[model samples]
Target: MTRTVLLNNLDHQDLRVITRRSAALGDAVMLAHTFPAEFRDLQAHYPIVFQKSADGTTFHPVALLGLQDGQNLFLDESGWTGHTLPLAIEREPFYIGQDGDEWLVHIDLDSPRLSRTEGEPLFLPHGGSSEHLERMTSVLLALHEGLQATPAFVSALLRHELLESFVLDVEHADGSQGRLAGFYTLNEERLAQLDGPALAALHQAGHLQAIYMVLASLSNFRTLIERQNQRQAARA
Candidate 1:
């Protein structure tokens, strides 16, 4: 059998380990990529379809981490519309690929330097633009999934340019839920104020550093601000 590990060239920067999967008897980590057990132990406490065969049973990563080789690694499934995970799942692991159960993801290289063969390692390689787009979309979707928590996440999303504009979808004591679109700009001053968790929340919101785009639109905002000030002075 041949297994291809895509995006081998990606630089796993700021790679934070969110959660791990374990096994029965609780002796080892569950590395189920191979045989009888193939499940992703999502570190999050959310309910998930751990294994296809298991029914009506929802468990967290701790339950599965008993198997050392059963498999255990971080599961950063924050921005997921997919809170639930499955066992023995394989995916293109990028945005531009198919979307569904056990969606997988990883970063892509600016220029993927493809070696002649798969096994042999080489200097950095390059993939095509389509691959790049896939990476971008994949990250965006993942980012969107990560922002479900944290107070004022919506405001943070707007600041980060993840949501172009939003309207009150529903209002309640809990807070407001709204639909988000468009993108925004971000600045160092603004970013530095947020904690790591907050930034992760914004990213999971599918902002994709959307702040850069909003920054590009600063001139429009300045104009609007000036116009409003002039109008206010005229009224006074």
Candidate 2:
């Protein structure tokens, strides 16, 4: 259950949020929704791919955190091992809400991260927004804008026929095997075959770089497999 309410300096002056990354705090996710704005940072540590929306009508970008359901290879006993976390993961317990023509911040009171004591305070002693709150607000704003631009990005990819379904096969040192499917990746061949004008158009739209970032991110699949292998070895 969730107890979501608009955030204000009053009535919730004592609110605090635990910022630790762990599975118990709901960080164990196989994938996280991503956007072109974050591609450069995310590509360095995660394999970016596309998955269809729940209704199967459109596609959206996501950062692959693990090879299977409910598994996040970047998370461990200490914390998240990745250098950068996707914006979706960083903005926890806080979300953007609309009230008529105005956008407001909302907090989930039911979140496990919520605490009256022993966490980052949302406001300072005089009821001013804390640095933590300000940072989270920026995160929320970026996420809002990024999500708003996703549909156009997806539409561009589809118009150019640059997406192709891919299946990843993995084998651990212990002889265990797994297959990850139902995801789409950039069709490099198609991208390369496009005419100069189309290429320029994609570049002018700022998607060409994002497309390359997605390709570059595929190399991190090896990193994920390595992490899985290490986990298996530790358990052995």
Candidate 3:
């Protein structure tokens, strides 16, 4: 359960947030919510895919981190091994909220990242937002804007029939097999068959690069398998 409240300088002035990467910090996950703006960086380390909501009426982009639930291949004793961590994962315990029409910052007071002993302070000695807070504020803003734009992006993808459900069959080094399902990816063949006018429209909308980034990110499946194999070997 999350105890979220509007962040204010008065009630939570001494609050500090730990930024360290560890399983204790709740980093174990197979995917993180992502946006097209982050597809480029995420493609380099994580496979970008579209995940449908539980109701199956909506979709959102995510960066794949592991083959199964409760597993993050990027996290080891040395910390997250990916070259770039997704902003969605970095923006921990802090979420953007709306008080009427105004956007407000909210913090999860019960998050493991919260600490009173040692960590980045949310405010300075004089009751002003600190640099860390400023950075977090920026992250919140970007995430808010990106999420707002995601609907249009998804609409465009659906308009062009670009999303397709797919499954991944994984064979571990020890000969055990696993399957990853319930995810969607861009249909490259269909994308290639799009009409010139449609292609131009998608290009003008800046979704062309994002689509290719998702395709390119599939190469990292090998990286994920390697990491998983390494971990299995270590355990052995």
Candidate 4:
């Protein structure tokens, strides 16, 4: 369980966050939650897809990192290979919390990234927030807003009937195979067939580009597979 408490400089004066990418630091994830606002940057390095929520209530967008659970192909000896990382992945140890009607920032005390002697400082010597903290605040704000806007984006896609189930089959060089399922993506056929009025509405809402970005990101599936194969080969 995550132990969360409201962050304050007094209690966390010496708090530091290790920014290095490593599996032991909780960087190994199957997929990271993303939003329409991040699709453009994320599409360049990761495959974007939508999956049903835990209760099957709704769907949210995610950037795929690996085919299997607890495996992130992006992490290596040096660091994450991608130039751009999903905001959800970058916002480690820090999370947004709700205290009644107010939003607050909370940090996981048990996270490996939390350190007192190494990495970026959360506060300055004079007890003011550091530049790193400011950037993290901005990221959290963007994430909060982006998550709030995602339902509308998903509604738009559902209204246009553009979401379709997808399955991926992978064949490794060593005669191993894997299949990925339980995800959805934009159907180009349906997107192209959208009526002009619907298309116009989506365009007006700034969702058309996001749809295309999600589609474009599918190409990264090959990139992920290659990474997995490379890791497998290295282990052999």
Return the TM-score for candidate 3, rounded to 2 decimals: 0.97
lDDT per residue for candidate 2 within 1-236, as digits (tens), equals 88999999898899999999999999999999989999999999999999998998899999999999999999999999999999999999899998898888999988998899978999998999999999999999999999999898899999999989999999988998899999999998998899999989989998888999999999999999999999999999
| Candidate 2: segments with Cα more than 4 A from true spot | none
Model 3 residue 155 distance off true place after TM-score fit, in angstroms: 1.2
Per-model TM values vs. the true structure? 0.19, 0.97, 0.97, 0.96
TM-score of 1: 0.19
Give the clashing residue pairs of candidate 4, or none: none
Candidate achieving the largest lDDT: 2
Candidates ranked by TM-score? 2, 3, 4, 1
Residues 34-136, candidate 1: write the lDDT tens digits: 1111112232321111122245222111122211233232221222222434332222122222247544443323212222333123222452233444434
Candidates sorted by lDDT, best first: 2, 4, 3, 1
In model 1, how many backbone clashes occur? 49
Ten-residue stretch with the least lDDT total in model 1:
31-40
Candidate 4, lDDT over the whole model? 0.91
The positional error of residue 139 in candidate 2, measured at the CA in angstroms, is 0.2
Cα distance off (Å), candidate 1, residue 133: 5.3
Question: Candidate 3: minimum summed lDDT over ten consecutive residues — where?
Answer: 76-85
Native-vs-model 2 lDDT? 0.94
Please list the residue runs of candidate 3 whose C-alpha ends up more than 4 Å from where it truly belongs after superposition. none
